[model samples]
Target chain A: MKLRRSERMVVISNYLINNPYKLTSLNTFAEKYEAAKSSISEDIAIIKKAFEESGIGEIETVTGASGGVIFTPGISEEEARSVIEDLRDSMSESNRILPGGYIYLSDLLSTPRILQSVGRIIANAFKGNKIDAVMTVATKGVPLANAVANILNVPFVIVRRDLKITEGSTVSVNYASGSSDRIEKMFLSKRSLKPNSRVLIVDDFLKGGGTISGMVSLLTEFDSTLVGVAVFAENAQEKRDRMNYKSLLKVSEIDVKSNHVKVELGNIFDK
Target chain B: MKLRRSERMVVISNYLINNPYKLTSLNTFAEKYEAAKSSISEDIAIIKKAFEESGIGEIETVTGASGGVIFTPGISEEEARSVIEDLRDSMSESNRILPGGYIYLSDLLSTPRILQSVGRIIANAFKGNKIDAVMTVATKGVPLANAVANILNVPFVIVRRDLKITEGSTVSVNYASGSSDRIEKMFLSKRSLKPNSRVLIVDDFLKGGGTISGMVSLLTEFDSTLVGVAVFAENAQEKRDRMNYKSLLKVSEIDVKSNHVKVELGNIFDK
Candidate 1:
């Protein structure tokens, strides 16, 4: 007996979710269903369109010989919040994350699987939102931006903390980050973004949300809109709102001088 | 008449090269050849494996009910030099690239198609090199690193100009970049790389070879071996006879403060 289209999609999505590295070709699906190749093709097109429309997963096609589709695991916003909370739980156990009242995420960001999963969850939250680009302040934010951009297939623009010989003339924006008394200048090339582009702002960590706001102001110079802001980790003690933004993990406070800290996972990755 | 494995591989590869975006499935190939689905599937497997072994292009699979394979266009090292030389020819028409004794690649790096081709060519040069990682300095190098990493399926790592709160404790190194007066500091997290890793260094441009040397030194601290070095452009003048690396385009010289420049395609893409 042949399965209904809905049934097939569910089965296929489940298969992709479980077998992350495995790829399947159309012939394989057709044989499994005892359906005509043409019908299978139609069914896949439907599934792909559904995935795109639903914004839960991405279906990539491989052509020529040895081609198959791999389903990337994605989560809805509510589900994403739970996952972030889980990571927060894991992070809170480590006393090393707080040294001098700061949440250290360098080790967390460097791990591939964590970054990959975090990236997917974050990207899924804004699927099909027509984000013109992903932007981040340079260095630490590059990898996070890269992961998000890869999932969305959009270009990632890195804003420099300082000018380099290669960057030519840059439009500089001034913003204070953390407890630094002096205002720091962040720069993006005038030509990096097009006019009226919609940008998704992402960063590894948020302390005061000052850098995030500065990026927002920077985007305005290009007439770009800020569609969303996401951070892998955020600290609530900073008393900065923009609670409007999505964060995977939230750190309430850290007493580095005393080596004590508190953490709260935002409800972003509920699953 | 049905096409044999060799014949199909060539034709399919050529088709992928020409069409670029259009992906045809095994079922489609079977229908085109009047062969059974099984036979076509087998043929595709062979082709995909061959691409992996030969490094001509990538065979990406699209799984699920209607998923199929797609070809991502890639070039060989020989082809890389040819394309680079073409760009070199165009860049040399005027001294525009040599403004202030530097070949400005900001405009080129920002261009999508150019970056795409450059990435493919570099990937080709390193095809089958067993590269474990792609490493680059921050900012402009990120785009090029992304392209090479995507094709190679290796993680790309970025070295920071300066450490931030997110980077944890960083291991810093100093190196002279070409003939520059000042010593530049490059940094990486102590744990970001494993000891004795095989790394491929990729950058957008090379001037004094100082940055490349710095990257090499940083890798050495982790006991990492330099597998190879690739750049989109290289300086032809003041050539270092002892260095082993590949550049897509070779720059002869740029008259100081003039828009005059000369360049040629490097031998890495000799074919």
Candidate 2:
């Protein structure tokens, strides 16, 4: 339906925000709102300014017969640091320390608000990379991967620890178990990922780095390339394989005897 | 940042869309945007009209000493039907059939675009219910639950088929397995959910309804109330105990030998 300029601007802003990284011709919006293409272009100009100024994201306009606009979601450094600091404070609570030095993170991972903010921060940290999919292990990593995938506007593939009949054909790999010295297997559906796609690996926690390394091998088997690795939190005490990665929070200390846990901003903020 | 009326409206629209089911007083926006309270109120008025006109959602204004506006995400019936119809067509593709009459839905579930639409549709169906969390079984149902919980702005609890030490203490329940006639156990972390929370159960597909039932019983152990149940699709041929729930698609027929499958809009659109 036709609307006033202000109302039309509001609706178009909603569309761009929801359909980030998508290219829509100005004519499409013009026809949908029953306005001139020139008017639609003007509305986008204003939206671009608003989105950039607020650090919500960046809007790129393509100029061609088939071009429109694309939104790359971003978070300001200030906002990102503030969000991670708040998470660090929550992670430091002594009550979150459980047996085996595991910090309880399920509550933070499952909450929508925290998940969305973490998603934006992670996605922004990987800016300028052409990522086609987000990869994570089953169970704990699903929501974190989902959140980041939602922001990147890409499909996410889950690597499972067990084989299921519903997955049809599958690809399997083995990695060293962190807690136990035994080797463990991980599986991914053959069709879940496409060959030659660039993938960003994400996880809820980083301990031995075994799981992430296992996923890296799976990527090679799929004939895909790894864009980078990101984790929600990392255990600094654990000595693992040295790998380049970014994390939102670092568990600097976890003393089970004293029931003490220390948390700080992760490598994502490191220059 | 201070902005013009049009640009400010664009930013405010972004805030409301990102933060649905949340209340923010005009003073907050007034202070942030460096605009008068009256101007901020006017911005919300225009936004409400635009949002309703486009069927994005409803904006409720709670007026009092400590009140502001709340956005309830919504989808128009016409749009919802169109989306469901498209999914029905995609589900009918014969290649989706597996050896044992299972449907391959990982592609659809993993895609952010489709999951977001399904989330809006499912969350909209249970609009009036006070949902404290979304519940589902692990491996397959995690993304579906995450989608719904994201829309509803609540945490989600996942019931696992196997025990993990990372979950700390958990409550386990037994249910009849659909594939195998043997009883299977499912577990939920003790601290993941609080007592007396109202939850909505979501899953990728419904066959024997055993898994959903398992989760429902698990809820009782936690002293949580069931708000409702929704599924992405249901198997029409499966003979199972009767249960009340909403489904987006129905697999009317699946012939593995002929490599044919029939799908149609589910009971979600039924009057």
Candidate 3:
């Protein structure tokens, strides 16, 4: 496992990037790479400088015996805003507008590059929070939740509209469906989430906020706490009451007749 | 963005790891880091050696004026086997068995690290193919498909058991429901996939292969070609017709009455 200093840094940086929000001792790297602790420390110093200068993230070195260096993935405010702006423009395409005022986001959400960027932006918005798990309603929100969960290094739970036998015992909650406005039940596997989990909720789109509310209730049902709510886009014209969440794109206008959709950067960029 | 040689290697490795299955010209790196092309080439030489020695992946340099370096993510067979073995043991846990013999897999599939590893293993199984999209059924299979799609840097399309208005128009196919042995319809959004795409099918579990068949039919319906099929696990005891797919874990036995399940490494490791 002995590596040259440059190769060691490359491998160490890869490890830190893959295992974000983790603490790794310099001794461990020194032993693995067969280098001196002082050399490892120097490597960390250079890595910290490179990461910070590139706005990739930050690395903190703890001095105590039980401490080590921790890497926190981050996205600069400027970068986050630019990413969302690009998404907003792409989302405003007329072809994305389906009948009944729905926008087709599957294409964008399914792209890894876009998902990775969006994940970084959303995770950055909720940085410094203790997130034990990410929760999202089934179907469209799974990938978004998965992306955020990946960045956070936490498990994600999916809330399904229909119960499946494979989920085993489940707890159900009734919420007003956004599309049909009917009282509908959503189910979460009983074993999917642990109690007292601080969860961050993520979804692809926020319309009536009913789905998000249902998930919040599920959090309470599982004895978990909500850290925050984030969505890819929100319908600005929709009359929503008493719900606060961060969205990357705001769909300000959707004229189905003229095939025109107006989109702007969402409130995540607001100071 | 001009960084020292050591720092540049770290950032370039990060970029390559994040953007696998992508071709990037040395000129791009040279321009981005404000370094000479020869220096960037030297950096890649070190990175390629580091990556190969660490089992990270392979960096192939394509020659000619239109040539560049393409990073193909890979895992050592030993590591892949060990990962699947660990999953096999975990899947064999008695508590994973639900009613009817279905094993709960949400926890494993939802974990980012596990998904990333599984994604790499599954993607590596079909490494030589030209896969344009990863296809799977909704809810349970979305994350698995997303994981594979992320590794491949392609879009994933989810086929739903029930239709949603948000999906716009969809192409529906009838397949025998594996659990109930009843005919059911699955729908894929018309816009979700393009025609003539070479798709790789992935799912959380393969029971009767009906769902995979449905997706295959849908692929044909969309004028797309099937590159291959991969699953996180497959039911070995299920009496299935001839189906060619790679699975990481095989469920040899599921004794619901005694709450015991037997799992082994699946066909993914088969030569």
Which candidate would rank higher by TM-score, 1 or 3? Answer: 3
Off by over 4 Å in 2: none
- Worst 10-residue stretch by lDDT in candidate 2 chain A? A174-183
Candidate 3, position B19, lDDT: 94
What lDDT tens digits, residue by residue, belong to model 1 across residues A62-102?
Answer: 77678877665465655556666667776776555534566
For candidate 2, report its TM-score. Answer: 0.99
> Positional deviation of A23 in candidate 3, in angstroms?
1.7
The superposed Cα distance between candidate 2 and the true structure at residue A240, in angstroms, equals 1.6
Candidate scoring better on lDDT of 2 and 3: 2
Candidate with best DockQ: 2
Residue pairs with backbone overlap in model 2: none
**Candidate 3 regions with alpha-carbon error over 4 angstroms:** none
What does chain B score (TM) in every candidate? 0.72, 0.98, 0.98
Q: Put down candidate 2 lDDT per residue, A50-164, tens digits, no spaces.
A: 9999998999999999899999999999999999999999999888988988888889989999999999999999999999999999989999999999999999999999999
Tell me the deviation in Å of residue A184 in model 1.
2.1
What TM-score does candidate 3 get on C-alpha atoms? 0.98
The count of backbone overlaps in candidate 3 is: 0
